[model samples]
Target: MIQSTTPGKMDRLAAFIEVFKLRIAVVSTPHASSPGSPALLLAGSEDEGNARVVFRLHGFSEVPDDVRVVAEVNFDNEANPLMSALPDEISVPLGGSVALQATAMAFLSEAAEGRCGRSAALNRLAEVLMLMVLRSAIDSGAQQPGLLAGLAHASLHRALVSIHEMPAHPWTVDDLAASAAMSRSAFMSSFRTTVGMTPMAYLGAWRLTLARRHLKAGEAVKLTARRAGFGSAAAFSRAFSRAYGHAPADLKRAGASAL
Candidate 1:
């Protein structure tokens, strides 16, 4: 019998952004080489400095603690993948063609302007920059294990897609291995090596991530637990608390307080 590959709705990289709620804040600085050239910089500050452009991933939150900063990069003459090449706070140079730089500069300029309806335009431009950075990172070849490494590996990418497509599925090592067309042992080893976590560990984290969103949206604990593939609300609460450093109830209360 011929086996079918599992269907994936979103690209793994895009799914990563969704799961983590990543956002981009761009600040334009004076170009070092050319005084008049506007150098677009990705910043961590929530405040848009001097009318900077901010682009948020899907389901962005204004709360700083709620946002997870996966990695930070400093663009240089050479473009490289940020996640795998550096530790938590390392800066990597972003290298791209002249055309790419020109396009980015144009977008930054438009984003920085005070035109009406510019927020929407800035958002679109920020999305473009995110893709550009990803492309440059892939081209540079990531040497470390991370989302970048997983994307670069065929088997790992397939596994990642399956996980993201069906987060509620009760997945197992064997099942994921089958999806990736690899033996269970090989799959387990390769996944940990590339993604920097065991398959089940990653799945648990993914589930809790989804659960947080549901809870924030005011879903009942039982419903959120079920949707996140936990056996019971109690179990889900424990896992959620462990991962987020707070009980689900606390988060729910905080969410309510915000309103």
Candidate 2:
């Protein structure tokens, strides 16, 4: 039986939690793009040949397509490949945007979880999958690192790993610099050259991201705030609102009822 705090409200919360958790499970699981967990690629005849589906966690879009997307869930930005480069077929012949939901996550679950240590394994696997996508995209000439070409450098990889491993470690420039085994000045310089943000900013973004996921999973706000390293629920709310454009309460309400 499901747990509940308020009659109708509990049902709504559970539904919201299930939807987001399922999405996370699919994305984080191995074999997310396999036959069993296929991604929905919406593109035109022209796009069919050129389009590729790239899934990256935290720093990248959930489903990065070079076409417009129509789906129930999303994690994209203005820089999203789909928003920027969707093929003409989507507008001309496909009749509308493409929708790919649930199927891909299904396959990912089968391959990633191995039917044991599911969510925990996926937590580690998400980074591996992201790196694979990044390497492939760069090799295939689909993504350009621009002046940030150093982003593909080894230091960037190290920094990413450090952030992922100690997301709640109250990281600072000094801490991250120590992790990267470089002086504060050098680490900051190299990090900016490749990753495009100052160390502190990146840390904040990473923390906010984890907080958002916990929120989606129906974790209590105060708990989520503390785990994400915020000092209090109010602080977490202010930061979350600033980063995501919505208060934690508003987001919880939307996730529960408006999803």
Candidate 3:
């Protein structure tokens, strides 16, 4: 079920660079254990900075004490290099059972339309919030900033960018090495050292992530495989199963895939 690994896999992820166009949404609710329900406020929109941050407020009537989120969990590009280096979850407490929730998404039309589309205030707000969360996390000693700092290396960063920009291209160590202006040996060693995996292995992981998204969208297994750079769905399924512990069609059926 193994397909030949190539640089094309990274191209799929490159599309996410436009995340600034998304909007941030916030929802506030009271905790159940509180004696009195708290007031709630939710606000969001599509605009730079606005879309990157979301503000939610909750009020408690009787409780004099408050719970607070002293630290945040950030996941901005400037923060980390690992594509999926995120904590399982983060919690922020509001005094007196008040809660603030933040979420973000790009306008459907803008996202589907193309780049150069209008960026939403909500998107900017979301970005800001993300940055804040990560900063908070680092400040609170909840996570290691060193992990993210290390990912900012120039060669690895450029390699990541190249993969995201051209996922469909057939890529090799030689090609990537040329792109990074490094000898093949140096590139291979550096990439493995930084990412903790071989270049081909990273490519395979990227392809699988893309194929899973397409499958969940009900695009059909064969089409998903081809688009993700596999020659056939059978090959995709085999690779998917090996990597994720499930068949490609199973992802389609579950409908729990991420794009």
Top lDDT hit: 1
Best by TM-score: 1
Root-mean-square deviation of Cα positions for candidate 1 versus the true structure, in angstroms: 10.4
lDDT of 3 at 2: 18
How much lDDT does candidate 3 score? 0.47
Q: Please state the error at residue 46 of candidate 3 in Å.
A: 26
What would the per-residue lDDT of candidate 2 be over residues 60-177, giving only the tens digit for each residue? Answer: 2243444332222232322232212222112122222132222224334545347876655543343333323333333232233321233235445445555654566777788777
Candidate 1 residues 1-259, lDDT tens each?
1123545322545554545443433333212212222123343332422222222221122223322122112222121223324322222232325544455556656655768876556555655565565555544445877766766676777777777768888888899898888999999999899879998998897678677777877778889999999989999989988887888887776664432
| Shift of residue 32 alpha carbon in model 3, Å | 9.8
Off by over 4 Å in 2: 1-135, 138-151, 256-259
Give TM-scores for every candidate, taking all chains together and pairing residue i with residue i: 0.63, 0.49, 0.53
* Model 3's TM-score against the true structure: 0.53
Candidate 3 runs further than 4 Å off? 1-14, 17-23, 29-83, 87-124, 129-151, 255-259
Question: lDDT of all predictions, in order shown?
Answer: 0.57, 0.48, 0.47
RMSD of each: 10.4, 14.4, 12.1
> Once model 2 is optimally superposed onto the true structure by TM-score, how far is the C-alpha of residue 166 displaced, in angstroms?
2.1
lDDT of 3 by residue, 136-233 (tens): 33323323332232234545545655665555567788887776677899988877776667767777776776666577667788888888887677
